[model samples]
Target: MKLLTLNFLTCAIKACKSSPASFPLHPRDVELEIVESDINLPFLKNILPRLMWAELRTIAAELGLPELPETAPTRDHLVEGKEEAKEGEEVDEVPSQTARDLHRVLLETTVKEGKLVCGNCAHEYKVMEGVPNFLLPGHLV
Candidate 1:
C-alpha cells in the first residue's frame, strides 16, 4: 500500500484500539517501489489536512526516503503569495514543491513487501504485493 494509507492504520488487536502508541504502525524491512504516475495536485491538497505529519516524517526517514517537512504546510502555505521567479523560473513553482513532495512520497511510492509492527502491542501485520494484511487471528479478533 501507499505510505498514505499506512498513516491511518493501527494494530488490529481489539484490545489495542484507540491507543495512540498503536497507530502509525512501524514499517520494517520494507521493499520500496517507485512508479511514476500523473501527479494530482488537488488530491494531494485535500489529503494534507488528514495526514499525521510527524509519523510520516519519521517513517519516511527510517525507510531512507526523501525527507518531508517536519510539519505539513498550512492550507495558506499551499496557495499563498507566489515564489520569487529567477529569470527563467516559474513564479509559482516553489510553492508547489511541497505538493510535489507529498505526491511522490504518498502516491508514487509503494511498499512492495514489509511488516508493520505495532509499537505498543508488538503485533505484526504483513504487507505483500503492496497490500497490508491487517487480519487478526481468530483468537485475537
Candidate 2:
C-alpha cells in the first residue's frame, strides 16, 4: 500500500479502534518497491493539507526512506511568491526537493510484503503483493 494510505488505516480490532496507538500501525518486516510516476506538483500541494505530516515522517524513517521534515509545506509555501520568501524559489513554479521526496514516499513507494502491528493491541495485519489485508477473523470482527 502507498504510505499515504497507511495514515488512514487503523487496527481492525473493535476494542482497539478508539485507541490512539492503533492508528498508524507500525510496519514490520517490510519489503519496499519504487514504481516511478510523473510528479504532479499541483496534486502534491493539494494533498499537503490533509496528511498527518509527523506520522508520515516517522513511518518514512522506519521504512528506510529519507526523513521528511517535522513540518510539511504550508499552503502559502505553494503560493506563487510565498515559497521564495522561505525557500528562495516558488514551490509551485519549481517543486523543491522536499516536494519531490513527498511525492516519492507518498505515491511511488509501495509495500510489497509486510505486517503492520497495532502498537496498542499488538494485532498483526499482513500485506502481500501490495495489498494490505485488514480483514480480521470472524471472532474479532
Candidate 3:
C-alpha cells in the first residue's frame, strides 16, 4: 500500500471507531519498497488539508525513514515562483524541494509486507504484496 493510502486508513474493528488511537495504524515488521511514479503537485496540494501530519510523522519514524518537519507544510510551500508570473503570460509552477520530499514519502514509498497494528485494539492487519487486508473476521466485524 502506498503511504498516501495509509494516511486515510483506520482500524477495521468496529469497536475501535471512537478511539483516537485507531487512526494511523502502526506498521510492524515492515518490508518497504520504493515504487517511483511521476509526482502530481496538484494532488499533493489538494490532499494537504486531509493529512494527519503528526501521525504521518510517527509512521515515518517507525519505518526508519527521514524525520518530517515539526509542523505540516502549507499548500503554498509545495510550489515555487508564483510571483514570477507576468500579467497575461502564464508561468510554469515548479515543484519545490518540500513538494518533492512529500511526493517521495507519500507516493513512492510502499509497504510490500507488514502488519498494521491498531493502537486501540492491538489487532494485526496483514499487508501482503503491497495490499492491505482490512477485512475482519466475523467476531471483529
Best by TM-score: 3
Q: lDDT of each structure?
A: 0.79, 0.82, 0.89
TM-score of each: 0.82, 0.86, 0.88
Taking the tens digit of each residue's C-alpha lDDT, what string does model 1 give over 32-82? 999788877666667777888999998899889888777787654554244
Model 2 misplaced stretches (Cα beyond 4 Å): 76-82, 85-92, 139-141
Candidate structures ordered by TM-score, highest first:
3, 2, 1
Candidate 3 vs. true structure, TM-score = 0.88
Clashing residue pairs in candidate 2 are none
Candidate 2 C-alpha lDDT tens digits along 1-141: 888889798888888988888878889899998989998878988898789888888788888887777788775554445545665543437666667777899999988999999989998899999899988786565
Each candidate's root-mean-square deviation in Å?
A: 4.2, 3.2, 2.6
How do these models rank on lDDT, best leading? 3, 2, 1
Backbone clash total, candidate 1: 1
Best by lDDT: 3
Off by over 4 Å in 3: 81-91, 139-141
TM-score winner between 2 and 3, please give it: 3
Please give the lDDT score for candidate 2: 0.82
